[model samples]
Target: MSSDRRDFVLTAGKLLVLTAPAAAYLEAVETGKAEEPAYKMAEHYWGMIVDVDKCIGCGNCVRACKTENDVPVEPYFFRTWVERYHVAEGAEHPDVDSPDGGYSGFPEKYAAGDGAKSFFVPKLCNQCAHSPCTQVCPVGATFESPDGAVLVDKSYCLGCRYCVQACPYGCRFIDPRTKTVDKCNLCYHRITKGLTTACCESCPTGARQLVDLKDPKDPVHDFLRDHKIQVLKPQLATGAKVYYNGLDGSVR
Candidate 1:
């Protein structure tokens, strides 16, 4: 199954590189003959926004991400996951848990009479502008793309876990099959062709949105300006791009 999956990816990559949409970019990178690169790094800046108030913890996003990306089937391995935060009344901290990486949905842990407010928080790579993961790579295998996406060059990667270690969000992981670090890249193959990431596409509640900060006409500009947003671990100052709305103060 893994071999077949890898073959599919290989075929898809080749087809993508040769297709009309990416032909010029391929020529520029592979042959250095194109007058201009097809996808300019400066033309786009990508990010995501999550409305905590809208998330339902249905597991659609998690399931879609794993299937779309061919992620391994293990509780510990996830490109994107969801955490169920149960904030007890008058408590300083919330109880957080993600069973099976929230792949199969959650059982009711709190009752209506439990006096706890429960919400779901989806988690993934922040794609930070000043990412600590990018800073710690011994090799340039992991890089922040010119278009503001954090991507990995699997061919150049040495299977080191430095990038994984430096990530504060617990986003990166070393793939047992490939022996290489892996994580979400906002579904670059899809996004470059004007498609949304799998998680965003599959979210049932419209809780997630792919945001483009560089486009003046993009709705993301207005959304950011209007909403009171927060990023995880602002104290680390990684310049995280993922924004959260209606985030509970008890969230870690």
Candidate 2:
């Protein structure tokens, strides 16, 4: 490990001990000692659910995520963005657009009662069980956490865009500042501390929810069982963990 990696591991260990009551989990290759680690990888499995019916095209989630994660305000660096779809009656494909990643909310593109239905679909890293990005990463900088969140170790990242190209959702991007491939991590640092993701916290109508599928009390279980849900690209068999309710056929 490099000096930066060593320092990070040491800092994480210190934070872990100070926040024990939170039951947070964060593991690194090594710091200095072989003593017992604080993280319990098996204790949780993380995921998210987006309710299309609840999203109002308000752009609150997008703005909150950008601010909280320090994602670049530029168009190409979105860790999470909302797409607005306008599906005409009996149309084969919807006119989809996410101008500036919908950071400033969507403008009135189509008039009301214009023979088209409009809705918003938020997009992010799927945290796939069989992620192509993770497979193609040569340095193993991008990895699937034991708790199921796909994360990146910037220190170990080689700044290769393989993971960026591998993602079908267009979620991964090269951070100009770090030159490291970046994507949604479900706010791993916050979630591990028992707090919800910034996006979820900012959603005005509960459009997004950060859930731990492994937790019986997480409510995602019943949400999945109770709702008619679908993954973004189920045909690829990515084992994507992000679920969506009322997903439209027009979304691409």
Candidate 3:
């Protein structure tokens, strides 16, 4: 392991000892010590449910993600990205934002009355079960956590663009300032601290849900079992954890 990783491990060990309750410290220590040397391969598979029925394309989630993450104002480094799908009565390949992230308003572009037919679909890192980004990382810089969240070790990343190319969803990108591969970590830092991801918390329509599939009691899991959901690009066989309950077929 690199010196930085060693330091991180040491720091984490100390932090656990200091923060763990007195009654749980010993158990925590044992678990931490006995744990695999590498990052835990997540036991559960996580997925998301996007309720297109509830989404009004308000862009609240997008704005919230930007403000929370301190992401550059440039039209890049998007932790959550939105796409407007303009499906005419019954047509495919409807006009889109031309990859520049520009789109007309709902009522004006799709007609106020017909807005129901044309809707926007926001996309983000799917956090796949069999993630292509994980498979392509030569240094194991990108990995899945025990909670089934995909993340990148920016410190270890070589910036080869392998993960960027491997992602079928086109979610990964290289950070121009850091010169490293960067993408949505699902706000792992915030979630681990008992907080919802910025996108999920900011979503005014409650369309996006960050769920723990391991816990059957989780509302998201129940919703998935209860509703008709769609997985993006399942053909690539990444075992995508993100599921869209009301995704229009044209979104693939």
Q: What's the TM-score of each model vs. the native?
A: 0.85, 0.84, 0.77
Residue ranges of candidate 3 with Cα displaced over 4 Å: 1-45, 98-107, 113-116
lDDT of each: 0.90, 0.89, 0.76
TM-score (C-alpha, index-matched) for candidate 3: 0.77
Q: What is the lDDT of candidate 1?
A: 0.90
Model 2: how far is 2 from its true place, Å?
53
Candidate 1 per-residue C-alpha lDDT over 1-252 given as tens digits, one digit per residue, 9 for 90 to 100: 999999999999999777976776776779767644376668999999999999989989899999999999888899999999988889888899999878999988778778888989999999999999999998889888888899999999998799988999999999999999999999998888788999999998899999888989888888888999999999999999999999888876
Worst 10 residues of 2 by lDDT: 24-33
TM match of model 2 to true structure: 0.84
lDDT (Cα, tens digit) per residue for candidate 2, span 29-143: 2443335546566999999999999999888988999999999998777989999899999988888999888899999888999988898999999999899899999999998
Q: Superposing every Cα of model 1 onto the true structure, what RMSD results? A: 13.6
Total backbone collisions, model 3: 0
With a 3 Å backbone cut-off (N, CA, C), the pairs that clash in candidate 2 are none
